[model samples]
Target: MASGKKRGKKPEVEFRNTQLADALQTQDMAAVAFALRHGPTVVPLMRPGARDDPRDTGEVWTFRDPKTGQVALLLFSDALHKPEAMPKAVGLHSPEWLRAFLEVHGDEITTVFFDIAGPHPMQASPADLIAALDA
Candidate 1:
């Protein structure tokens, strides 16, 4: 049988947690924390910039639980930057920079808070958030 219609490939399903996406989009630290605890797995979509201008803004990160394999997505207003201790030679907002930063500072990152040019700061404990997420 001959058919005129062309078949198209099905879109790949990349897990993007709606709850986490909403939280990050609004920059709601509390919500972000909540989602981190309870939401699905996620991975960052890495897009490198040119050598001359190497700043990438509006990065999206996907968080994934190692055990459950749940996925979630988070959007950052600005590109992820290297820690102050790092030299400028390290590309800013690059995945490599972020990996280095996390390797050094991952232990220190316990909670999520909204501190970007706004009043009324919010805080959440990692333990509590983890508990909530596990529940």
Candidate 2:
């Protein structure tokens, strides 16, 4: 026999980070770094409806805290900067640095995903992405 039952909705979790919000508003990289170093755990989120292309687009990361259950979106894009001043590279892909970063400061990152485009900020629930990072 087949049963048709609906799953209950999960409780809503609100993400908030005043410090990261302020840093983002002011466009201060140092402050942003500071927030990441002393804020919350961040998990990356893939863009909605984006193709599974090997090439990278806008990056999005979600910051969260297991204790407080707080979450916030962290968006990254060269579009946010002047053409000449666009960030040319990121070392996050480096396994050694990434591991060390997560081990040392996994709880301070403001955003979960890191995108390369513009104006697509959205909230997301925590998932296996965090586990992958922890692994």
**Predicted model with the maximum lDDT:** 1
What TM-score would you give candidate 2 relative to the actual structure?
A: 0.28
lDDT of 2 by residue, 1-135 (tens): 546877779884333334545666665655555544444422233442234753443353344578887654433432232122333322123223334544544455443443323233322222322444344
The Cα local distance difference test for each model comes to: 0.41, 0.40
Clashes of 1: 13
Question: Candidate 2: lDDT over CA atoms?
Answer: 0.40
lDDT of each residue in 1-135, candidate 1, tens digit only: 869888999896444445555676675756765665554433234443454754543233334558875432222222222122322222113234434434444455544332222222334443444444444
Among the numbered candidates, top TM-score falls to 1
